[model samples]
Target: MTTHHRTRWLALPAALLLALLPASASAYPNPGRVTGDITVHDPTMLRAADGTYLLYSTHGGLEARTSTDRIAFSRSGNAFNSPPSWWKTYSSGNDPWAPDISYRGGKYLMYYAVSSFGSSTSAIGFATSSSGKAGTWTDYGIVHSTTGSSNYNAIDPNLFVDDDGKWWLSFGSWWSGLKMIRLDPATGKSYAGDKTVYGIASRPTGTKAVEGPSVVKRNGYYYLFASYDTCCAGTSSTYKIKVGRATSPTGPYYDKNGVAMMNNGGSPVLESHGRYIGPGGQSIMSDTDGDLLVYHYYDGQAGGTAKLGVNLLSWSGGWPTAY
Candidate 1:
């Protein structure tokens, strides 16, 4: 969430054929099942009301695309608001990144981040669409803000409705790491102070930089997936997908080796496959088939850049393994 999370060396993504590998092949699914190339990054996808997987990925600013097959895609449109007045528009500034699109109360709710690097002054704003398409989206200014001096650099945001139907928002930076708070479902505001941090992905104890927290559940296990080290620095980022699992939503998550996730004990679910660098900043979706972990990887298929990758996810032995 914070702008302080810098980039590391790029990792070439693994081979695309790993998608066809049998699910029982390995414990960790690094190269996902869904395959293709388009340079998708910080991806957020949903099975929309119209039966389309509407993928809103971070394209400098937020852009909309849709795919029914999950492999083929078509661009839909750009950010709903055309850049709000409060957010600086200098040099195509204050991009809308890492979006969370959901349908509640028969209306679509979109939570998007507006910020630029080297500045802690960031904000997570809200938008809405009646049809979840190109037209009719209204922006609500600044759901949360970072003064460019805050320790917890607010950026990547995730919205979830728990088992009890309680809504909450999880966000923060790699500097101070990831955090969560109860949300006012009616207002989309934090019910408690953002200070009450729940999950913190601090920089490997001695080192720094850890952000992009995504939380989901599978087969009664709550899996906390996050990208640590660096992302988007081309070949300099040391991006990897690490996860901690728990029995409950608010963890106390443990790795496959029985180590605690809160204690920085996450087994690797996604790491670089040579040139597939920074394969993190992930999201998940479910359909008639199953759950899918959607994220980005530095793809060399198009001369090397951070492109989006989707892999089918399966839970085995209480751990999340990609296909």
Candidate 2:
């Protein structure tokens, strides 16, 4: 969640900016107008029924922020004033990571990961809030996890509910790539009947850096989006967002070219170009304007500082294009 490295870089020259820009001109879309406490990582956002925009991201006790018109954001304390005591069972520091939040069953549900850096001994924990406010969440303990003996690292939890009312949780990082398991709609835990952990995406041969899985259903197809390559290196980071699709939530997802995602097939949704060095760790949210692609990018113009980057997504071609 929180990276240790500090990035420092000079701004791009005007001449080089034109050359580095995407060829189509429209290919390079600027992040939506936002200001005030925009520093964040792995951000997931939702508009409350009262029209308040709540944004939660990775940090100490899962940092929180709020927006009134979706443009300007301000710090609103953290989800927890102190780390949950049970967190020590999984994370050595008792600090949690990427938090996936959604309004489900008329209440706010958040699933997050707790683990040490580069360690497979990780766990995905759950929490709920009646009012989705800071210091109001109740920890529900671990939903799922993997020990050092397991091949897959359990982190970056994402909850997806299908139209038929089936709940699926997709999560993973490194080791064996992205994974999803069926969950009980009521408890938000693994479904009792189906004990299947489906493999959706992987980079088997080279760097197994693909992670941060988020699933969104658009036009009858379930699209799987994930972050690929090295992250947390600031401007030196190579993280980029990629996508694949399938009819079923538990997928043998394929890219635009019909290549299976399990074999490293993914179409680039967003990448480092121009001044947006390493744009990734993305989550999709349906806003009043349209679908918003929210993520953290190392700002090349600001010494590679991690900043919030949000762009509206256009899916006219049956594939997502960020603008």
Candidate 3:
């Protein structure tokens, strides 16, 4: 494994070492150290075949950043030189948010959402790039969307390709929480035969703030990691990363304590600690050493600036614990 991909526990202080003990509501660890051009929101990162880390996030035409060591990042420009014309329909400012990037079938596919704040008339857009870098993306148009009449808002999309060769896209925000749909891998769009909109997780009783679903399979279990509560309010943001697990990707997921995720059940993976406030908008990335819990947090020390946060995850006791 590369030096950047190794477990970094040895460098952490005693207080931060408490993160490895168990999942606790109030004992979350501070974000691991990162520097240079780290200001981001709803960030997603993937290491390219050439071992360069490409990080993408909300706004600025889905802003791009690059890192060779995964510790020091440099601004690399936007994924698109010009926003797609269709973006204006959902977001008047043509702002795209929460980009999910993955490498599949010899190409890089990006799934992103375009919508104004708190609007249900949202659309999830698709694009492809051979290089997974700025200026190479070709917008493929909408894969899924919603209107004010719909019960769920379509945004914060994540594409998960199951081990059995099934492609699934999980997305949604506010309105009615997270939803999933089957995708056609051939065209990178919704699958025609399966018109099912799977309900994965939600808060039925209070605060329907769950969004940003990142699904990955480990040890024969499908784990769903999502952001819970409010996001984007700077220091006052209540966002925190939570998780659940199920036997299937389209799941009736349960938290660590056997609470159903569809009814607001989620085990806390990371939350506010010290200078890190509202740590959420997360994506899980697999590295050589282990799975990484990659997300953005409002930096209280920096006057509530959104900054990139990265931490290694340990799946001990069948639940993810971030340190």
How should the candidates be ordered by TM-score, best one leading?
A: 3, 2, 1
Clashes of 2: 0
- Whole-model lDDT per candidate: 0.70, 0.90, 0.92
| True-structure lDDT of candidate 2 | 0.90
- So what's the TM-score on candidate 1? 0.83
Q: Which ranking of candidates, highest lDDT first? A: 3, 2, 1
- Which residue window of length 10 is worst by lDDT in model 3? 1-10
Candidate 3 lDDT at 112 equals: 98
Better lDDT candidate (2, 3): 3
Q: Which candidate's TM-score is highest?
A: 3
In candidate 3, what are the lDDT values of residues 1-323, reduced to their tens digit? 23443446567787877766566545776677788999999999999999999999999999999999888999999999999999999999999999999999999999999999988999999999999999799999999999989999899999999998999999989777899999999999999999999999988997888999999998899999999988999999999999999999999899988999999899999988878999999999998777889999998989999999998888898889987
Off by over 4 Å in 3: 1-26
In candidate 3 the C-alpha lDDT for residue 81 amounts to: 97
Error of 2 at 286 (Å): 0.4
Candidate 1, residue 47: Cα displacement in angstroms equals: 1.3
For each predicted model, how many residue pairs clash, with residues at least 3 apart or on different chains?
Answer: 29, 0, 0
Number of the top-ranking candidate, with lDDT as the measure: 3
User: Which window of ten consecutive residues has the lowest lDDT sum in model 2?
Assistant: 1-10
Worst 10-residue stretch by lDDT in candidate 1? 1-10
* TM-score per model over all chains: 0.83, 0.92, 0.93
